[model samples]
Target: MSKRSNWAVPYLIFLVIFVALPLILIVVYAFQGQDGGFTFKNVTNFFTDGDALNTFAVSIEVAIENTLICLLLGYPAAYILANKDLNKSAVTVILFILPMWINALMRTLATAELFNVLGFSLGKGTLLFGLVYDYLPFMIYPIYNVLLKMDTSYAEAAADLGATPVQVFGKVTLPLSMPGISSGILMVFMPTVSTFAISEFLTNNKIKLFGTIIQENINSSMWNYGAALSLIMLLIIGLTTLLLGGDKENAVEGGTV
Candidate 1:
């Protein structure tokens, strides 16, 4: 073992204690009944319960919409920012990132106040807006990083070969940026699906997403149900990550070929 390898010891310990331990507890709780006996009812309820199914569907819809909107908006912004001729691009990037420095709760509360001032009614539309606004940076940063790090030679070569700007972007830039797009989708989608606070503030507790349902369950001392719900969410996010990971890997391989 090298000395540099020892540097990971603390991180490994932290992961096991905080991350692994909590996941283990969730699994344990998810299978435990109110009488402290093993049962699969909590897990089954996720599939069989109508309310649970509705919440799950709503969460999926919101997450998908949020991800799509972010991609549509973030991709173009990232492309613009990545332009070499854009003056003060660094400053523009900084401005985009500056909002992240404030506390999330503070920012969320401020957004809620802004909506109130504008007389926007609290509903699903506002909730969607809040989700997108809060997570937009997560989408932008990944794409921007990938664009920034990309070699210009590929694009220049394509241009020299008489490829139009659209063709160059479609064939070269977009394909090469798949890894970043995948990452951004994961970052935005996962958080939006699991978000409670944004829904709460934006909709005034009228909208109950998966995260809100989990929060309610836990608060009402339905730990087993809550754990099961959380595990379901974990599975969805895990599957999404796997799918996107495959796409990213394929993109990288394609780029190399």
Candidate 2:
């Protein structure tokens, strides 16, 4: 084998052991009953149980809101950063990423304390603020990377053709940056849907999302049900990733040609 192939052997082994094995176990447990008999009851409970359904709805709502907020905020910030003069842009980008250097748990706790001090009660609103704060960087970086690499010639050409600044941005910049937008949405939405920590910390356990439900079930020894819930979440995230990633690939390919 080539040296490159040899270099991949360790990573392949790690993937199989750490990723594939756990997924196989989850699938197995998802279909198994408490007595270890195969059954679909666990999956059925997710839909039929009112609490489970509500939790799922709440998670979806939070995820959608967080994703939209991130996109709305990140896009303009990324655009400004991408267009700034080199030195200033570099410093600004560093400042934007600085929060990521701190531990996530610490940041969440800090947010919680800050909210408490400001008289904001622990609830969905605080939870959302934490999620947006934590995941906004995920949205910004992807869009910024795409914008930074975009060809200036396209915008120049449009402007030379007598297109106004707004027209150039609408017709050229936004379309070309769609791949990054898709990527950012996927990044923010998937984690927001599945994250338990931010909700737990910021809401002080007052809010129960789908991820919280899964965690509670697992902790309460309802392994099969928890696994089933996890499987459903996995399916939703996988489908979303497939749809958005396909769009991103198409946009990238079109831009290339």
Candidate 3:
């Protein structure tokens, strides 16, 4: 092998041991019974369990809500940051990314404390707020990078054709930015659906998201069941990623048109 290819040996080993092995174990355990025999009970339980199904539905609902809010908020912020006339300083971009320097747990704790200090009760609202705050940066940076990298000639050409600013954005900028928006949605939506700590901290353990259910089962020594739940979540996330990937490719092709 070439010297450059040799450098990948360590990373390949790490991937097999840490990533591949863990995923294989999850799948193996997911189909195993507590007696260590092969069975389909764990997977069947998830489908038959009303509470698990309800929690999964709730998690999806929350994820969709959070993704929409982040898009609405982040797209404007990204647009402003990318627009040279609106924002010129790199410092402004850094300011938006500064919060990410701190760990998410720390930020969530601070938010919880802030809400407490203001005498606000913790519930669904706080959960949503914490989720959006943590994931908004994920959404913004993707769109910002895309918008910033985009050629301004398209918009300029549209303007020269007597297209209004709004028309230019709608016809040119928006289509070109769809790939970034897809990436941001994928980044924000998947994690929001599967995050446990943020929901726990913000809601004071009142709300039970799908991740919390998986965690609870694992903690209770229901390894097989937990693995099944994890596998389900992994499958859903994988499917979403594939769907978004297709959309991103389509957007790229459309932008070139």
What are the per-residue Cα lDDT tens digits for candidate 1 across 1-257? 99999999999999999999999999999999999999999999888989889988998999999999999999998888887777345889877767767777788888899999999999999998888888888788888888888899999999999999999999999999888888888888988888999889999988889999999999999999999999999999999878888876543432231
How do the predictions measure up, each by TM-score? 0.92, 0.92, 0.94
lDDT of each: 0.87, 0.88, 0.91
lDDT per residue for candidate 3 within 10-87, as digits (tens), equals: 999999999999999999999999889999999999999999999999999999999999999999999999999999
**Highest lDDT against the true fold, candidate:** 3
Model 1 lDDT, residue 189, Cα: 90
Off by over 4 Å in 1: 1-9, 247-257
Which candidate, 1 or 3, has the higher lDDT?
A: 3
For model 3, the run of ten residues with the poorest summed lDDT: 248-257
Candidates 2 and 3 compared by lDDT, better number:
3
The runs of at least 3 residues in candidate 2 whose Cα sits more than 4 Å from the true structure, single-residue gaps closed, are: 1-7, 85-87, 247-257
